[model samples]
Target: MGEHWIDVLPVFSDYWINGEVFTCQVDPTAQAQVSPWWQVPQRLIDQLLKTDPGPVIAQALQQLQETRADLYGRFSPALLEMKIRHLLVQSHGQREGLMARIVTTLESE
Candidate 1:
């Protein structure tokens, strides 16, 4: 069977201080239609974050590297490298936010 493909639609949502929310229009130049395999690194990183203490950057980077190696043929090398770096940075930001919340909760107790 041929590879399964999915369209990547970027959605931008905005929430105002008054509780109003709206979805922004999609940018035509940023649209991409790719296979689900391209999302493996993101999915893996998300799963790792579900653990009790969360995952280390190395673990997420390793997972991304492995996924890129396995699916090298599906995407450009440069694109895959860029995706890996992007995911690592994104994961770091998420971990920092979680840690801040935990610290705040603990301090209040």
Candidate 2:
């Protein structure tokens, strides 16, 4: 079968920026081998940070947990949990960094 491709752009809070198109190749039989198609833009991150981050973080955590459950028996659950915990910690640090940047920007004005 021929490969199928779809283009996508990241959107934040109903706003979308132009000029960025991510092409994702879809292979019906090779779901596990498919790679991520796009990078999260810095502007999108900034816009998300400007709003309440709780729902976003909660959604991401739910997805991570679901993925871990889906991949059960393929790897050690303890190891996967450890990695997920680390990622959550990193997300917290990212929030702090974003807040710091906002404060700095405000102070400079």
Candidate 3:
């Protein structure tokens, strides 16, 4: 299947099964780009220093890109893609499941 981005989901992946194609579901929290994707720098510190957090966010993103590039250099595209897919799935699962676990524990207690 060719690569394509789903407008509703904001996910860029294609899935093929038994000659049918479908878009994968994305996490609801990640439905918006500004949610977990970007973090506000230390609020009190930034406010006290009167520094913008935008540059800090940009630097963090740059560092992540560099790390990803290094990893890609050391691995095949297929392997890297698989690793990224696995990580994304696990991250989303953890984010959703953690809340459920907390709620269940509180109810039990």
Q: Which portions of model 3 miss their true places by more than 4 Å?
A: 1-68, 93-109
- What C-alpha lDDT values do all the predictions have? 0.45, 0.45, 0.44
Q: What would the per-residue lDDT of candidate 2 be over residues 1-109, giving only the tens digit for each residue?
A: 1222233322222332356544444555643433466567988787665565554445544554564344433445455444444444566536444333433333343
Which residue segments of model 1 deviate by more than 4 Å? 1-70, 93-109
Badly placed stretches (over 4 Å) of model 2 are 1-5, 9-33, 56-93, 96-109
TM-score of 1: 0.24
Give the winner by TM-score: 2
Quote each prediction's TM-score.
0.24, 0.26, 0.24
TM-score of 3: 0.24
Error at 10, model 3, angstroms: 21
Global CA lDDT computed for model 3: 0.44
